[model samples]
Target: MQAAHELSQVQLLSVSIVALGFLYVSWTVTRNLLFSPLRRFPGPKIAALTRWWDIYHTVKCDKFKVIHELHRKHGPVVRVGPNHLSFSSPETFRQVYVKGCATFLKDRDFYANIQPGLGPKYSGLFNYTNHQQSIDERKLLQAKLSPSALRQYELRFLPILDTLVAIMKDKAELDLFAYFKFLMLDAIGDLAFNQSFHQLESGEEHQYVIDFNNAFTLIGLSLKDAYYGLQRVFKYAQTRVDAFLSEEKPKPGTLMEAYLENGKPKPPYTPWYIALSGHGFIVAGSESTSITLTYVVWLLIKHLDIQRRLRLELKNVPPDATGAHLASLPLLDAVIKETLRIYPPAPSAMPRVVPSRGAEMEGINYPPNVRFQLLHRILNFRLR
Candidate 1:
């Protein structure tokens, strides 16, 4: 009986010691997190307190809208994270994007989540380390996208546009966005790969393009507000998204296949480079064109007078005139400019890292290892 009682006593003491040790560790961790170097910067306490707080809001809110509101409330320099600032000033644009002379490196922790096994090869949008390499790759591809190329390709694209108008004219009311997406996709394929998707004629989304768009948007939203500490969780989510995207099969005669066959910089391209560059083109080209078309349609709906003016301008063009000549139409140019100003596709801020030894921005000293974001659209719009 005495032995049993003594054993129970020892067990209780051991349990108490273990509990106390855990409590000590938890308290220390909490203290370190709350009182870190970033504690002095102002932001939502929850974001600073826990990465999950930022992630929740980023994933839930219309990211662009929320960031705008935050900028308004917090002023040009808002501490978005423990070591981050969102700058909404002209100085920021020049300093970060131009004058700072630093490459706009991808936020790796954030991008890694979006860029799952996109294979070991790094795409331009997600690879900061390979900036020069990607730039070189981009230059090789640029000949195909040059102004001269666009002019030469205009004949091919014009027929597609005419086909679009013919189709749209028959409908009493159409999902203009969907139709525009088709036109853009088909046009891009023809221009870039010398083939047509005929997606509009078929009346269905290209599964590969659809998958790429879905994956990109999901990855963007998922990482928009994640703090560094919660990266593992975000990466896990990204891996699943990327896997789904990579499974998509490429269409024959598509730009992807062209890259595979014709090769970039040679007849037999590096598969990884081809994959990255091809995916990069599709992702960027499709989204921007779609957004531009959507915005124009929305603007036309809002301002019928403007739309009428545009029609008058387009109608005045000679029937035999090239699309290149149509670029001279002042109203068409104005409408495009207005639409771009109103809703820039990549209105999101460009993030830059401070110098390793710290740097001065507009006479203010920002310590090293800190991040500064240049809200390009906001700053430019505000200047106007």
Candidate 2:
């Protein structure tokens, strides 16, 4: 009986050890099965696991060149992480951008980092639910940017531009960057808020404008890193941004003010959300236009003959003539077009989530919850 008891104990010990081994084996097998496909899709192994690796490379090196090189080597589509795929082909761009058949929408992770906060739920851009929402916002804003509206804005803009030209007139070797930024600030305030930043007239920069610019750039640079659950660090950064916006009071009759007065529970937008959305439009409108002009100037500096030609075209226009007359100048317009094509302000990949039903891509089935990016720069360049 003693021998039988000892044998039974030994058998129990063996069974326990076997069970532990099976559990480990099962875990290893599951990880391999789930993660191996991503491994095969082509990217650094660390990037395949987390976006931190990709973000590190982008922050450390020339971000644009690094991403471009990755796509050039990896074909039109490459997995940047477990969930993210970067697409470079025009066909994908057309399907995603033109056809508007994107299954995935903007990642919430991207927007949750907004510092001052998101704008009105129904404001110009940020609050939209679907394509219909986007359409509605665009339609509302379209009238605001139409020829008549632009003409009105230009009346306000010309005085600001003239003030800038006066500063540049005798001031030799001006810091072109600073003056350009000031012009944009003034323009945005006048056009969007019906207030003067006075950046041009005062010949001094607005503290709020500078703070907003610095904060905005820092946020964009950190977005990818923050998206993979790095909220602790980003939230701290956002806190500083929130402080900046707090210093400036909202302008009456401006979008932020309008939302504050009319906002309620029944509408499509909230007060804070509308304020945030207004911030986006103001920043986006000013910065994008400024950057485009900057690139155009850079191009002209490289090709002095083009600069002279543009000058000649401008000189030909009568002082009393409309901005539309100059808009028809093909060469000047071409320069603008080329600059837009080359250095697209919106260069990053726009993300979309795969539908819950699952979708087939390139003859392989992508399961639900997969995220894809449509790289605008890659698509436009490849077409060239």
Candidate 3:
């Protein structure tokens, strides 16, 4: 009878909690539709009520298309969430992002969600939304990715490129997607740690590479899944940093090993934070570069005349030509940029929150806590 009584009490508590949750959601939805400042913005009534509408489209893999459609239906600005508006107008983008950047900070909630449990000390450059902190972090990391630093890492890529060419020679037909992904992963690994993944030689994906991809993919669906998956990536980076730091041999000047000045880490670059930075670096670099390269290759193949022109342009670039030499190649550079414009690897919304003081854009005064997002639609040039 005591056990039965306890079970009955537990059931009652659960029912009460669910009831409270429903009440809260309903109250918020009512407030959003009837009282929110963003209610003036153009969007479907359902979207103005809650963020679930946006999440649904995100999960359905059509958020980009859907957002563009919303813009078509409701001009350049469309309300995407209760407090969020998607901006595709060039003038609005320039005003909000370019002219009023100091007032428009990166959405704090979004960056906080990506790193999960980490504090500001562990927050990487990408996650540092504060204007000053972002500037400072960029100054610190900019050295590691500068022309001179990348030139050092560029040597490591040569052997890998030769290996890639050899692999292509052996296969009459091959899926370039995996190869491109592996190639960039290997390059990023060398740039992050003092080690190459050697995936081209092994012809297999590394666990670290696989986990990084998994974590990024699942991050959108569930924060819990992202946090755990990212933990694996963080752990892998830690292991690599540990091994690299402990090596008795002469250290290579990779991002990890380069942090040492006079055999000790520089200010704000302890082993753990170095690992965190490397985690950010790997996450930021790999897949996008590979995607860009793959699309460039595919587009070139489709337009063989342009490809022939590109090949002729490349022949002029000497085998030992540095990055400066490559940068000077007009057609080569144009093709890469054109490909990126046509098929952006990350064609999603990047949201920035309006400062507490509010913002005026294109004669509209937006209240604080409003999320202003930039979409790829801005890249399209209409026949004006």
Best-fitting candidate, measured by lDDT? Answer: 3
TM-score of each: 0.74, 0.74, 0.88
lDDT for predicted candidate 2 compared with the true structure: 0.63
lDDT of each: 0.62, 0.63, 0.79
Off by over 4 Å in 2: 1-40, 114-124, 127-130, 214-274, 361-365
Candidate RMSDs in Å, in order, are 7.4, 8.0, 3.6
- Point to the candidate with the largest TM-score: 3
The 10 consecutive residues of candidate 1 with the worst lDDT sum are 224-233
lDDT score, candidate 2, position 54: 61
The full ranking of all candidates by lDDT, starting with the best, is: 3, 2, 1
List runs of model 1 lying over 4 Å from the truth.
Answer: 1-37, 101-104, 113-115, 122-128, 213-269, 380-384
lDDT of 2 by residue, 1-384 (tens): 999999999999999999999998676556643655454566555566667766776567465566567788878777776677777766666665566444555565553444433333323365343666766666656656678766756677788888889999978887676678778877776555455678866767666565554444544556543332223323332343343335455333333332333333125544334444545656776767878888888889999999998898888778877788778989888999999988887766557766788766556566676677765567666622
- TM-score, model 2 to reference: 0.74
Report residue 114 deviation for candidate 2 (angstroms). 5.1
Tens-place lDDT per residue, model 1, 286-352, is 7677888899889998999998888888887888886678788888888888888888877655456
lDDT measured at residue 93 in model 3 versus the true structure, 0 to 100: 84
